[model samples]
Target: MQDFLLHGILAISAIHMAHCNPDKREKYATISARHQNIALSQFSPGLTEIGENNADAYVLHAICIFLVNTYSIANPQGPITSRDVAQSFILLQGIRSILALPFAHRYIFNGPLARWLYQGSVEPAVGGNYSSKIDDLLNLTRSMAPSDDTLTCQSALEGLKHTFAAVSTPQHRKGLVWRWAVSLPQSFLELMSQNHPMALVILMYYAALVYAFERNMWYLTGWGSNVASALDKAIQEPWREWIQWPLRCIREGVDIRQVEPLKPVEGNPRTQLPTINFNLGLFKPSEPPP
Candidate 1:
């Protein structure tokens, strides 16, 4: 299973590179197809193993499938479709479900894979006064979703901080966004469902972080930009002001931290943020699927 995962990663990397260099697309596409087939074929057995008591391996399998799905939509040959976008969300949900398993945290946190998924068990110091920025966002969330459970809001804030630390660091890593995505408490998702302005705003900043490091990898190309745009469009007035900085960062191709902080709207009363279709495909490729 590990070997299959490794091959899938390599094949995806090759596909990204091939996408960048059009000359190799045909050859790498064939190779990628083979890898995808092999990975998919093994997926059932690997899943069965986890179901049959080898539960410790669940994370590994989830990560493997996650990589496969990521590359599939990122393939340069065509634009991602709504179906692809839906599949991406399903894949992420599967990974999140595994991570949420009671016994899974011990293995995920202690195992070597943790290094790839998280910076460490202890929170790393983020550069600048970012904590304040995070706090502001959290406070906004509280104001926006007054009914949201306090504990869940706090967990979401911590997850945001963790993602900020990972992205703000000089070193770029894949899966940081995924880690943050899975770590978000259910309450956070509830906020998103309600189109909480603060929730969308935080996601915009996260998208900016993803955009900042996009140049380092082929798979990350366009992801941040798409997410930022979608969120910007989905959000409405007063709340929209909160995301201007991140949206500007996306448009200007600058780090979001370099942008000025959002000024608080002094007289604004808490109002329900208008919801949009806001599906997983909002960040998926805009072009037709291959």
Candidate 2:
């Protein structure tokens, strides 16, 4: 397992070096290929062993998989292929399953690996400006769904809040956004699969968050905008209004709050919801909304 992890890390480094110095691409290409082969050989047995009794090892293994996927999709040699996206989703789903285990939280919270993978507490900042927005979204979602689905909705909303907080923070931490991208609870994916309005709204908001990182990170180029565009097209009327602000923000490369707030319609539940805002600064090179 340790050997696989080491190879995964080395593969990531080689890929990054290749990205930075095209002249050495052939050298790094050879290095990345060798490390990737070794990691792939041990991947299955390593995961099986970790699954037996070591939650820490399991999470570490997941991170290594994430790093490898990051390198593949971000490689400048070509456009991101459909296979790359599919593979990332598969690996991310695997991580989510490991996290679902009862002991997973302990490893994520206090384990030595926590410093690298965990994003602090799940608790949102109380009384923070964005808290109100998240709360409103949660409340609205609960109102839309059955009581049994409330937990799922709340969990998804909280995940969105976490993503917002991570992206809003000043630094560009690679794992932060990637964690959110992959770690979303299974319930969230189910809601998305069903095309639930609340779910689409939450996803659109996340898309906007992704857009904010577009200019700054090589790995994230076009990802944010692509997600926003896809969601905007996927969501239909009434709900379309819910995502308009985010879509507009991404299109204009401005913060969502900077877009003109949507007007509330009398007797319309959607319009009554407050505009979502992130107090965190926008990704660099973005102009203030007009």
| Cα lDDT, all candidates | 0.57, 0.57
The residue-by-residue lDDT of candidate 1 on 45-127, one tens digit each, is 55534442344355565555565455454332343333333345455566655554555555666666667654554356555
lDDT of 2: 0.57
Q: Give the TM-score (vs. native) of candidate 2.
A: 0.62
lDDT of 1: 0.57
Predicted candidate 2: what Cα RMSD to the true structure? 11.9
Q: Please provide, for model 2 over 123-151, each residue's C-alpha lDDT reduced to its tens digit, 9 standing for 90 to 100.
A: 44445434566677887776774764667
Candidate 2 lDDT score at position 162: 72
Per-candidate RMSD, Å: 9.7, 11.9
Return the TM-score for each candidate structure.
0.65, 0.62
